[model samples]
Target: MSRIARCSCGRLTVRCLGEPSRISLCHCHACQRRTGSAFGIAIFFARARVAVDGVYSTFTREAESGFLVSSHFCGACGSTVWWEPARMPDWIGIAYGAFAGTELPPPDQQVHVKQRLDWIRLDIPEK
Candidate 1:
């Protein structure tokens, strides 16, 4: 299946093709701040499997794993759509929320559970 992930203003669009390699929920502080939420749901696919149209602004930072992470967002609306972690150069992670009306599968793994807020309970079990 394929899905189109676009910014709020519909300026930047990502055509995510086929199935994702993995889906993950991250409770790390960096993810929390990046998403401005309790956790982040990321759909991972090979970079070549996704096509991006339109220019994007990016934010780069060193992750807790010591690898550089680059987040790409819409230059017009500042809505983050995807991110690339340097450690996995071939992979692209798209924000699950970016795909409206599409119900993706549950996360295969959940990381940084220690950083999760107490009020949030998913019980999706870490892999």
Candidate 2:
């Protein structure tokens, strides 16, 4: 079954043509900065299976792992919807926040915990 995610303004929509390969939380400072939150949730899917509609812009940055990652968002509302790693061009990472009705899956893992904010806590049983 396909899943649909859209920007807050509903101007940009992405159709997930297949199930996600992985779902996790990123605690890296760059992710925190990009999300303006303690961490970011990512759902990984094959690039070829994801279809995007409407206009969006991508901002590129180098990850701590030394791979370039591009964050894509709706140009009109500035709502980040997905990302893609330069090293893994065939895969895309959809932000959990983009899903409007679906329940988010539990994060499988947390990356870059070292860069987590001092006040943030990810002490949930599943984390």
Candidate 3:
């Protein structure tokens, strides 16, 4: 299946050409801050299966795993639409919320449980 995920202002977009490689809820501190929520649902796809459009600004940082993670966001709306993790060179992660009017699959797993809030509960497996 194909899907399109765009920034809040619709300036930047990611065209996903097929099923995602994985979907997961991340409870890491960085993800929480980046999403401004309890967790961030990351939809990962093979880099070869996705195409990005429009000009974007990038923020690169070293992740907990010691790999650099580069986030691409629309400059106008400041919405982070997708990111590239150096640890997973062949994959790209799209913000689940960026895909409007689409019902994507539930997360297959969750990570950084140690940083997860105690009030939140989900039926998904832990990674």
The prediction achieving the highest lDDT against the true structure is: 3
lDDT of candidate model 2 versus the reference? 0.86
For 89-115, candidate 2 gives per-residue lDDT tens digits of 888999898986896677777777777
For each candidate, what TM-score against the reference?
0.95, 0.89, 0.98
Give one digit per residue, the lDDT tens place, for model 3 in 19-105: 998999999999999999999999999999999999999999999889999999999999999999999999999999999899899
How much is the lDDT of residue 125 in candidate 2? 35
* Per-residue accuracy of model 1 over 1-127 as CA lDDT, tens digit each: 8889988899999998899999999999999998899999999999999999999999999998999999999988999999999999999999999997887888988999889899988868785
Clashes of each: 0, 0, 0
**How much lDDT does each candidate structure score?**
0.92, 0.86, 0.95
Off-target runs (Cα >4 Å) in candidate 2 are: 118-127
Who wins the TM-score comparison? 3
Candidate 3: segments with Cα more than 4 A from true spot: none
Q: In model 2, state the lDDT of residue 2.
A: 90
